[model samples]
Every structure is written in structure tokens, then in C-alpha cells.
Target: MPSPAFTDIQLPAPVLKGRGAIGASDNRYELLSRVALDDGWSQEEQPPPRTEVSFDTSKSIIVQQTALDLPFRQSLNIYRGCEHGCAYCFARPTHAYWGLAPGLDFETKLIAKPDAPRLLTEALRKKSYKVAPLAIGTNTDPYQPIERSLGLMRQVLEVLRDFQHPVGITTKAALITRDLDILAPMAAQNLVRVAISVTTLDRDLARLLEPRAPTPARRIEAIRQLSDAGVPVAVFASPMIPGLNDHELEAILEAAAQAGARTASAILIRLPMEVAPLMEAWLREHRPQRAERVLSLIRQCREGQLYKAKPGERFRGTGPVADMIGQRLRLARTRYGLAAPAWELDCTRFAPPPTLGDQFTLFS
Candidate 1:
């Protein structure tokens, strides 16, 4: 046997329809690099990759967080990669852990946790398990397109409902409205809150940034529906890209408030790891005129770099641009009645679900 020869392959990078990334880039841990190059041969363009779903057999579903700056102490992600395909997703680098590219592969190749409900039930039943607000859609959107057919998120919600556990969900999908049967009741008990992220009000721009997510109008409609159903809804105008969508901040908050968002929040764009390159490529392809200005403004906030990992500065960034963005958000929040504190999901009402054997005790 001979050792295999490893060579980098330069393939074509095309702007596929309904996809956020220009092409798939090799993961950071790969021993070989893959790049796109034109071979000068005339050939028909290949169709874009179709989304593929795979299963994860992990034993646990709940993840404990030690990050003090995060709003939640615990979280669960039902999917590994997001189909929403937002170009600036902060979680893109996580796909590299599975030896997958953080670019197109992150959106096309998806992983589902089929056993999440079962594992969550077991964890919640443990005596050592302390009741806290469990966050869903923290890393990946739990209600991505695949969720419509998989129903994994709905099943997990069932488990949470059975235990009367508190939960917070953040998503850019309107598919969540499909679970109003579960959410409305939970909201009545002060056990659930939903935050919908609307990145841009311009339909065309939103299509480019988050190709697969629901339209901004649909998200506002989702907020209205949730609020009409009595579920407390919050609006997230997140990852505000300076010199680009930042101007829409006030408009977004005002729209959400008109639609019934009780609270609002925002995060400056974060370009960590492979995301920076992907975003730069996307900008060059889509907004070539303003690409340089956008990147320069981002550097202004990140202290002359694409990104800085400082604890307090990561979310809001620094410098005058970031400060002004924050100031504008505060003003919008106050003006639109979105300055209220986040809803306090009731954790004191958590009750352990009765086991099969315990059900038999009723007859005894």
C-alpha cells in the first residue's frame, strides 16, 4: 500500500440561485486546500447542490453555556447547519467541526437530531436538572425549512410542554406559526417567548443576504400572528451591517412595534473565522459598488480588523460607528415602545412529567 497523494483542486465557484454562498470553501482543519479556477474549457453550468439531511445520534440534547454575556444559560439546537443560508451567520464555522465546509455545504448539507425530544425528556427528568429558560434556535434556526417535514422541533416543544418548562426561541422563519397550538398555551403560562429576526425591510436585499429565510413582510406577519394569539413576541434587527442595512434599523423596529413586538434588540455584524471571506466574496458579487465602504466601516467598529474577540465588544463592537448604531437602536426602542424589559418566562412553575409507570399509580 502507498500513501495517498493529496492535491488541492481548483473548481468553479458559481453564484447559484436561491443560495447565499458563492461556493464551498474548504474547512479550516483540512490538510488540503480547495479553490475555484477557470480551466478555459467551455461547459454548461451545473445545477446547484440539493439540500441533504442526515441524522446525529448524540446522547444529549441540552448544552450548558458558561458565557456570561449570553442571555440564556442553557440551549438546544435541533439542526447542525442552517438552510436559511444567511451570508453573515456567526455559526457557520461550527460546521468545520464535522469536517464540512463552512460555505455552501453548510446550507446544502444539513444534520438533524431525531432523538432530541427523547434525550431532552431524559435530561429534564433528572433530579440534578435545574429549571431554567432553555433557549432554542440559539445556534441554528430550529424552524428551518426542513423542520416543516421533520417535525423535530414540534416534538421537542411537546416535551417542554409536558414538563411545563420555560423556553425562549429566536428564528427568522414564519414556519414557527405552525406551532401556535403549542405556543399559545405555553405563553398563557408565561413559559414561552419568541424573537423573530428581521434583517432588512427591502425584499430584494433580504433575498440576497438571507436567501432562504422568509420575506421581511412575512416575518412581520408572523409577529402579528403570534402577538394576536397572545404569545409575547420580540423583534431582533440583528447583525446590522454598517454602510448597508443599518439605515433600516428605525424602520424595522417601527414595523415590528406596529405589528406588536413588545421588546427589540440588535447586534452588529460579526465576521469570525471563514465568515469574513464568505461575506467579502458575497459583497463583491452583489454590491461591488459599496463593498469596500462596508468592509471599511466594519473595520472601524472592530478596531482596524475584520473582527476582535474581546468579550464585551464582540456583540456591539466599538468606536464611533458602533456606538452610534447602538444609540440609534436605543432611540428606536424608546420611540416604538420597544424599550420594555424582556418578558420573564416563569421558571417556578416547572413540573416533572409523569412517567408511564406513574400514570398507572392513578388507577392504584
Candidate 2:
């Protein structure tokens, strides 16, 4: 066979509107390396990739959490990828498992588990199943944009309600309010508590940081609505990007508290795997002036790297900068009256739904 000559033809990627990632780089697991370069051709900016959803027929929905550092013992994610294209999303790296680019594909190409409700019911029905607060939205937002049409989250919530199982939900979408009919009753029995993540109060910054997520004001309103409905609402000021929205931490907590958040928590920004380069590119494109400083500070917190997967250090970084951020959060928590004891969901109320065969037992 003759060796074929390859022509060098490089083209620039089109600018996608309403997306956080600057480029759709190849996943880490790819065997081949590919890069794009400007070929001097005039290419107009392209529209954002259309959202696509594929089904995941996993047999189990509940994931047993073995990590002791995490608060929940079990968790469920109704979707594999989130449409809310937050540039700093730690979960973006998970898309690589499907051999997809963790940048754009993580947001544009989604996986939906329509069987989640049934799987959750089956898991809860297991004889060896123990009652514990099951978490939702741990990896991806349960109420992401797709949920509005799929209603899978609502179905899951319905299953939990039927079994009287306790659940802890974390979300950045206001769509959660649509399920107030289900959640309010669960809250009445102390079976549910919700955490609304509000990353930044600045609308413009939030738009750039979390491109498809609900606005900060909308999320705060969701907290208020949930609180007024007698549901315990926690404000999650997560991914506190240093040299960027870190300055808005106090304001975010304050606004959330004022809007009736009973508790507040914060996590320092995490840039693991493919997320590091995506975030770096996003910074250079959106906030060019402060991109270098932001990255430098992130490195300082991560112990001279973009990220460190150590459990304790990953959530809240180390070093003086990390210490200061923690201190500020503590002070703000106390100041905003968010130092209240954590709301514990009732686990004793869990009971498996009666099976079809169990109907005969009603007469007994």
C-alpha cells in the first residue's frame, strides 16, 4: 500500500450562542488527537447545538453513595447530562464515559432515564433496603430544562411520595415549583427538603457562567416560594470561582437568606478533567482581563494545579486563599442567620408501596 499524502486544512469552530463552553474538545479517552486551526476562511458564528435527549435503560436508579464525605447515603440522577451549560460544572467530565466531548456535548447531548420512577420503586421495594435520605441532583440538576418536557423528575417525586420515602433535592431550576403539589405534602411530613443553587447575584455574570440555568433572581424566588410552602429551603452558593464571582458570595447568601433560605452552603470551584480547559477557554473569551488572575488564584487553592480530586480538599480548597473564603462564608452564614441546624428528612416514614399481590392482605 502506498502512503497517502494528507493536506493541512484547518478551520475555526463557529461561535455558539447561549453556550458556556468555548470549544467542543475531544474526550480524554479518545485514541486520536485532533485540533482546529484558522484556515483563513470566513465562517459565520453558528447557532448553539440543538438539545438532544437519548434514553438510558439502566436497571437501577438509586446509586448507593460509598463516599463517606458526602452527606447523602444514596442518590439518583434522572439525567446524565445537564442542559444548564455552566462552564464550571464538575459533572461535565462524566460525559467522557459515553465517549462524548465533555464541553459542548455535555450540555447539548443529554441522556434521560424515563424508567427512573419504576427503578426507584423497585430499589425501595427491596427487602434489604434501608431507609435513608435519598438525594436527587447530586451529579446533574434533576429539574434541568429537559425535565420541563419529560416530567421524569415529577414522576420520581411521585414515586417517593407514594412510598413516603425521604428525599433531599438540589437544583438550580425554578421548574421545581411546578411540583409544589407533590413536594408541599412531602414537606408537611418532613420527608423532603430542597436546596436551590444560586451561584451569583449579577445577572450578566450568571448568564455567562451558567448559560441555560435560571437567573439568580428566579432561583431566589424559587427559594421563597418553597419556604412559603412550608418546605425547608437551603441556598447553595456553589462553585465559588475565585477572582470572579467569589466577591458576590456574601451578597448571594444574604439575598437567599432574605428570600427565606433556612440554610446556606458553599463549595469552591472545581475544575476536574475536561472541565479545566473548558473553563479556561470560557474565561479567556468572556472575561479576558481577569482570566489569568482567576486561574492563578484557582491554582493557589488547588495546591498549584487546576484541580485536586482529594475529597476534603476538592470541595473546599487549601491554602490562605481557601481559608479566607471559608472564613468569609462562616461569617456570612452567621450574619445572615443561616447557621441554623441542618434540616433532617424523616427516614422512619419510609414504607414500600403495596404490590399488586399484596392487595389480598388488606382483608386479612
Candidate 3:
């Protein structure tokens, strides 16, 4: 059993607790320390510390191909690390590649690709480049809070509009509604679709687990707005942790079905690498009473491990508990009148935006 007070843990409390990860350690070493409140300490005497976010402009924006067997062929990550620090996010360990702590740093220290639009246009304009529905916001939420000011997602949409290319978006933020001007027309042309992830409908629980994400109501509204706009919309009740939000599986699907969502999907929670310790800490702090049971259920799905690395098996685990969850999802979808039929965007309509030299060709 992995406990929060495990001796090998190192990261600081402020950096990890309630923030996706629990501590920071590099390939080199991890800092281990004991954090205890003094006998004289009082709630009146002090308050919690805040972790400010910082961003960086990354050089590369799109990954040409994915090693994973996802539905899509290519994936673009507009941002590295996420502001909506969901405690069970599988992407947290990716921060370790940059020599940063996967816990707090994975959520607070973010990296954005401001150059994505230009690079995407460049890639699309290539005569040899093939067209496929490019998946956006796969690694991090492209419409996160910072996007209000950055407007990078809107810019990316503009580029896709210029080329009349196909795209599929996934997000938890209601902010996608702000881009209907671009998405609506694209939808009419069969050039765009969206999937909104609703983790749990409980407002209080969402606040504790997903500190910076939009409220569940807001995300549900996003599905409504998108579906109303002629855009194909789907719901993802993802990272369904046991003893936590798993009980709401049917309700989430039913609500999405009522909200005009065309289809629904789900995945079991994954706590790979640094994410395990971090999520364990979150359990201990937020739901200590059910912490052990939660971990036990997770283990039941994960083959008695924190998580398994196998490809297809990892998304939906094996064993009776996992099987029951899968069966329940199918039954709920059927009961709610949900069907995940293919919503393929037209690829034949693609055309490269004319270049400066093409202006002269027009006169000729």
C-alpha cells in the first residue's frame, strides 16, 4: 500500500498537495524532508502559500506522429504542463523530461507554443504533406485560462480555416464557445469536431481535484453550445478513479446525452511514475477516510500495481472490476441513447493558402 507519508517521498507540500503531483525530483536526486506544524501554530497565525504560473515559448509545436495507438495519426500540444491540474492526469510525468519536478512544476510551470499557427500553416502548405484530422489539445488543455489572453487557440483555428483543413479538439474549458465564429462555419463544411472531458459533476470535488478547470456546469454548457452550433460534439468522462467519481459514471453520460452531446467515452485513472505519489498525497489530504479503499480499487484495475504501461490495456484495465466498469459504460450509453458513430470531417476540401508568389501567378 502506498501511503502519503512514505519515507522515500521528497517534494514540498506547497508544490505538490492539491496540485497534480506531490513532489519534485530529478534524474540526479530527490529532496526528502519532514514537514510538520509546530505545537504553537494556529490557523489564525498563517495561511497557505500560492504557486504562481510561468510560461515559455517552445520552439516546436506539433508532433508529426504519435507512438501511441490513438484514434488520430498526429497530435499537437499547444502547451506543455496544464493549468487545470487534475490530480490523476497521466501527462504529469512528461515534465520530468525537462529536468523539472513533475508535481507542482507540472501544473504551475507551463510552456506554450505561440508559434504553432505559423508552423502549422507551414506544415500544411507542403506539397508532400498528407491530410488527416489533426488532434489538438491532446496533451494539455488548449483553451485553459491563459488562452483568454494568449489567443493562441483562436489563431490556430484561423490557420485551419485558411487551409480548410480538418481538425478535432478536446477540452474541459467552456472557453471553446468563444470561438464559434470560426468553428461554426468549419462545422458546416465538415471540417471540425470536439470532445469535452467532464471528470465529475460534483462542484466541490471538482474544485479540490481540478483546481483551475472550469466548473462541471460550464463544461456541460460548452457541449450544449458546440452541439447547437452544428459541430459534432462528444463527452469524455475520463480518468474515472475508483471510490471517488466512479459512482457518477452513469449520471455523467446521461447528463451529456441530455446536453446534446452526440456520443460518450471514458478511461480509467492512470497514476504512472511520479503521478502515483502525487495522487496518493491528494487522496490522503482530500478524502482520507476513503483513501485506502480508493487505492485498493485502483489496484484492482491496475493488476495490483499503481498503473500498467501496456498500450491498449492501460486505457481500460483488466479483471472483474475493470470489466464491470466497461460493461456499465456500455449499458449507460445504451440507456442514455448515446452512440459513438464516426463523425468524419471531409478531407477532399483541403487547399493550401496561396503564397506571395501565387499573387503574381493570378495576374499571369
TM-score for every candidate vs. truth?
A: 0.95, 0.95, 0.88
For model 3, what is the error of residue 222's alpha carbon versus the real structure, in angstroms, after optimal superposition? Answer: 0.9
lDDT of each: 0.94, 0.90, 0.83
Model 2: per-residue Cα lDDT over 200-226, one tens digit each = 999999888898999999999999999
User: Positional deviation of 215 in candidate 1, in angstroms?
Assistant: 0.4
- Residue-level lDDT of model 3, residues 292-338, one tens digit each, is 99999989998899899788888898888889999999999888877
Ranking by TM-score: 1, 2, 3
Steric clashes per prediction: 0, 0, 1
Model 3 is weakest, by summed lDDT over 10 consecutive residues, at 40-49
Q: Which is superior by lDDT, 1 or 3?
A: 1
Where in model 3 is the C-alpha error above 4 Å?
Answer: 1-12, 15-59, 66-68, 360-364
Model 1 RMSD, rounded to 1 decimal: 4.5
Q: Rank the candidates by lDDT, best first.
A: 1, 2, 3
Highest TM-score: give the candidate number: 1
Overall local distance difference test of candidate 3? 0.83
lDDT, model 1, position 358 = 71
User: Candidate 2, clashing residue pairs?
Assistant: none
Among all candidates shown, the one with the greatest lDDT: 1
- What are the runs in model 1 whose C-alpha is more than 4 Å off? 1-12, 359-364
